[model samples]
Target: MINSTIKHLTFITLIIIGFSISFTSCYYDVEQELYPKPIDNGISCDTSTATFSVKIYPLIQSKCNSCHSTAISSGGVSLEGYNNVLSAQQNGSLMGTINHSNGYNAMPQGAGKLSDCEIANLNTWIHAGALNN
Candidate 1:
């Protein structure tokens, strides 16, 4: 009877130990998988090649031309052509509105703001004299 009780207790203790090992082994706190860092696609923001036709005008066409084109001219703003764009940049309204500065309306109305790269490209173009090119 004493030997049988000892064997039973030993079996139960072994089962509990196995269960504890299985549960703890399966439990994982993988920090890398749980909280993944953002992947870098190796793409860098290059504003050095910023140009009116290549960078600025296309961006404006896609973002601003919807409402500020020659046909629509919402809020008395026209961003259709290079001349009109230069005019706006010169008048301080383009950057003011896009930068969402005080006393100026935020542009791309009813939509999200432009990306930092896009804004930086515009700034680079403007600082480069906002030429037709």
Candidate 2:
């Protein structure tokens, strides 16, 4: 009787351990999987060749001009053309605001911040003289 009881308890413990191992192995972290680090995967960013007319202006117009254009400029800032954009950059608001850093208003006020690639491309352009090209 004693031997039979001991064997049953051992079997139950083994089954519990097996179930725990299987459940833990199947567990997944949904957040990490959703927001994995950005990868290139052979798709190029082309920051080196970005230009104002070809690359920068369209992006600015689409993202910034809705609130920052000449017609109804928000915060007294107009990103209508290359010169105005350059002035913003020179005054340090361009990077500060977009980067969501302190001491500057966060841009696209109610919208999501710019993506990393967009910010990197803009940085490349600014570092390359914020040209009118």
Best by TM-score: 1
Query: What TM-score do all the candidates reach, one by one?
Result: 0.67, 0.66
lDDT of the structure predicted as candidate 1 = 0.86
lDDT (10s digit) by residue, model 1, range 1-133: 9999999999999999999999999998977666654222224567877998788988999999999988999998899999899899989999899989999999888888887778888888888888888
Lowest summed lDDT across 10 adjacent residues in model 1 is found at: 35-44
Per-residue accuracy of model 2 over 72-113 as CA lDDT, tens digit each: 789999999989999999999988999999999998788889
Q: Global lDDT of each model?
A: 0.86, 0.85
Quote model 1's TM-score.
0.67
Identify the runs in model 1 with alpha carbons over 4 angstroms from their true place: 1-43
Candidate 2: list runs displaced more than 4 Å.
1-44
Error of 2 at 130 (Å): 0.6
